[model samples]
Target: MRTPPPTTRPAPPRAPRRDLYAAGAAVLLVTAAVLVGRHIQGSRHTLSVNWPPLLASWDPHLGPGTPAAVLVAITVVAYGPALAVRLPWRTLLPVAWATATAWTFSLALVDGWQRGIAGRLTTRHEYLQVIDRFHDIPGTLRDFTHHILLGSPDHWPAHVAGHPPAAPLTFVLLDRIGLGGGGWAGVWCITVGATACVAVLVTVRALADETLARRAAPFLVLAPAAVWMGTSADGYFAAVAAWAVALLALAVTGRSPWAAGGSGLLLGLTCYLSYGLTLVAVIAAAVLLLGRDGIRRRPVLLVPLLAGLAVVPTAFTLAGFDWWEAYRLLVTRYYQGVGGVRPYGYWVWANLACTVLITGLATVAGLRRSVSGLLVRDRLGTPEARLALLVCAALLALLVADVSGMSKAETERIWLPFAVWLLSACAFLPRPRAWLTAQAVLALLLNHLLLTGW
Candidate 1:
């Protein structure tokens, strides 16, 4: 009776190398399938007919002046780690992300260039139309440049007209690129910005786990809305850049408080630069707060967010700007009447899907990981509870932003992150069942879409 059962040692844990490689390959295949399917679906129109001139204008590494160069540099460095990691799956993850990002961005730039070149080719009136629009300004060219670049509250005409010329910073950057007219350049900037953002997102998710990173890689790279908006739409480049900076901040902050602060500052600038980035700021804040214990010991984590916030508006004010008027004139004009407060049924439906996707994955992850899985659970209080809270906050903020965003514009595309966040939460859960299944289904569907237009 005492010899009823022979004790056996637990089986050794399996190495993740195989799983990681499989995950990476699967994600890329799914991404490629989706893109092909979309292209085959005839959704790929020839927007940029004069792709030759545009391709000739393209410069990979160097752009123009301070801002342009700074942005491109950041874009490349932020993605540098993809080259350093040895895992085949890990390497493929970034490569896939970069490839998709480049394709989508290039497509959009071609579209813009086509439009610009066509306008030039078709009508003498086209160039004059642009100048006439600019010439209608009440002030001198210098005044117009200053006013358009940075709004002037003093002039009521500039205030009421509500359309200050294009952002001078954007134009200045374009000009340095040897772009005399900005139509195509604007498209390029937006695409690069969008690619940078995708890179940041992939990199951060990878930082969490290579497998998880691989899982998230495809959706972001092949996201329809993101590709279309970045490539097909204009004026969203800065918004894309803002998103990249925000995500970068989140990734860096994972290292220490000082990193957190710098991330915060970037987050703050994002808020200033694009109304869309308010969503990012909220997400960044939650990531910081939940991980605060990890960073609080370092303290410097608060500097960047605070400094950026302080500097942006303060600089504007010091230059004799009016805060409230500027807010109404610029901020309100850009973001107003957008994102339906009361959205259509699909809005509610997508939100529900996002919740289920995120929560299910996160729960599975929670079940899979043991209490010993967390590094500081014993000392930092309830790690699960804290993580849950932080995720919840981010979800709530995203929901609010998404809902509000829909009212303003067709933000359904940009809201892909809602789904991503939901999936990410599940990935962080303890079990693989929920996350693996959901992502698998998503990957398959996306693949089907790419391959067969479904």
Candidate 2:
């Protein structure tokens, strides 16, 4: 018996999976080729009803190839983090944030201060003056709410008319602080860009493991979605929604009442920022129910979150206007405007194509692996599986948006929040560097070759 006890068999060695890496690289190259072809053809045939004229007119101040070359350089710099993945979390975090900020500024500030900042200000002011008559904050809110129910005598800013008070309230705050111009827009872009990166890391670490979070960091930093994060208010909206999910993640993992409340407040704020962001409730719910232990404590999380969400809207309701009614009226007004310009038939597929472009083709491969992982009973309860579920939730929300006809075009910016989650699918990529490169190429093509109003 003693002799038999000494006989322990040696473990078998694992096989190398180099083929997976090759497959990932191949997918990346093919995707990059497709995006390049699209960019060339798109210069001739723009899909956007609003920006067709702009796209058709080539106006690159940095010569024709300069934009592409600059983008390539930025893409190469953004890869620094992926190369340094083994570094400490503290070191990696700053690098990720810095690269993301630089990348955003590079794309956004391509035309220099005048065209980037002053020009944007001029456009905003003209639109504000023409559409809303250039009223003060209180006056603007009053008129905005009034026009929500009553059809305007004049054409109003579609964004102002459709969003809650919080949307324009942001500009009002900016004005009060003496920071109301295209320069401020650029500032907002950098601030939101950095915040989004942090929120995403926090959310990933909370929901999954630190290793996974670190792996996701580079992709988040160099997201193709930066094409819009530089100039769109939706960038700020993406940050807000991302933090909401992150706090919800914390609330579930730590079982903190305050975190739950904070999550709810942010979620409520997102609703005010954009009507469509209410769909993020799906992500919140998914986070709350992610782990087995967390399931029983869902009410503890939901109650505070709902209470926090109700606070601001409740005040708005008591002040004078009912948000529900305003949103209802907006439905009709929204369609009468862009809905007619951008048809559902074209935008439905086009938006999906934009998503593919924005998230990279490796995402498609990762998504397939995630789906397969989710389908297996043994893997169903793993963190990767739960995260995959979150990605699916975002995609499902996007599908609903495409089908609704409310979002005709401009989805590259509009889909920023969803794209954040889509990037999560990159976790399943065999070689993250390959996927990041693909994303960088796509962002370069989108920002440099194409002209978008956002």
Candidate 3:
């Protein structure tokens, strides 16, 4: 008789000493940011931020959305887990999106309509400030790099000049379609940003397995990161970047040529949306590595993906918008503006504090489990490890951005694209409702207590 080959199965998860300790570390980081940030802002006054780590101010109050935000939080915490498990896959995706949209909208409304929904993107620093300037579209594209430097004539606004033409062009197209003003812009951002929950769920299901995706759905929907995603253009950018990754997951797993093309299209656009999003390629690389079966015939997928990827840059380049030139000038402009004043020594660590506050305490503990899962040799092919790799890829990208020094303060909002993925760590947690409650409470407190500037 021949002996059958032995197999290794995933062990059941348990509470470890590291879980509590990891969470404690995150809390300590936030406390240190607050204490240290206050001292620097009070003395050197060079942080260029009102709320040390974050860009917001402290204003405790409530509004019409307070009850709704509380109710949504309660409902999600009380029922989201069970419902996530029970719902059909198709139904769950839309439900998650709707719930996330509601949560974001209600939280934004806590600051009321004008301050929250209708005015976020209308400020002097926002993309909307340059809509009229983009009326001469082709001309503007050719002239884009000319205005990137701070000393340039009629220098572009902070938001407009900091990003590629695609960022402001989005609002310009919206205005041309008759949805002008901050209300429409804010609505567009929230509605689209909320879809990121669905994208993450789909990617999780396709890349790892359905079980992990379902476990992650509630956390994705109830994320405190939605506080910034509600109105900021970065929220819109996060959704685009997320769908790019999701489509890439589908393409690599199923080896569908069409899916690869779509993924490529979005991934290219994601780069133009925000330079930092180029780091998403890190996560995409992880997906490719994990999808072993799909990569056997790499050319089948890569060809279409590369083709779709070329469309955006080709169009911009032909139109005379020099992406490379603009970025070089942007680097120089960065050092010339507030980027010059913000102390790298202070922001580098404090930014992680912003991450903890935005992602919530549940993620701290969840990430601890993620790292532990990675250390196991036998579990590399298991669903938990697959998820951990994805989460870690995102963490690596965020850390790279932090270390690059381009992202100092305002990371609470600026890091939304990466922060959304970090919430997926909650899938690794046990006693989900307990952790969900913590996530909910953290979000409610942050929104009601502090006024965010995103």
The candidate maximizing lDDT is 3
For candidate 1, the TM-score is 0.50
lDDT at 87 for candidate 2? 62
For residues 400-453, what per-residue lDDT tens digits would candidate 2 score against the true structure?
888987776667778888788877766655556665676777766666665556
Q: Work out the TM-score per prediction.
A: 0.50, 0.82, 0.96
lDDT comparing candidate 3 with the true structure: 0.89
lDDT (tens digit, per residue) of candidate 1 on 213-261: 4433443343333323333222243334334444444544455444444
Which run of 10 residues does model 3 get worst, by summed lDDT?
1-10
Local lDDT at 50 for model 2: 32
lDDT of 2 at 189: 52
Ranking by TM-score: 3, 2, 1
Query: Stretches of candidate 2 above 4 Å error?
Result: 1-84, 121-142, 148-151, 295-299
Q: Which ten residues in a row have the lowest lDDT in candidate 1?
A: 47-56
Output candidate 3 Cα RMSD.
3.9
User: lDDT of all the models against the reference?
Assistant: 0.38, 0.65, 0.89
For residues 295-334, write the lDDT of model 3, one tens digit per residue: 7866579889899999999999999998889888888999
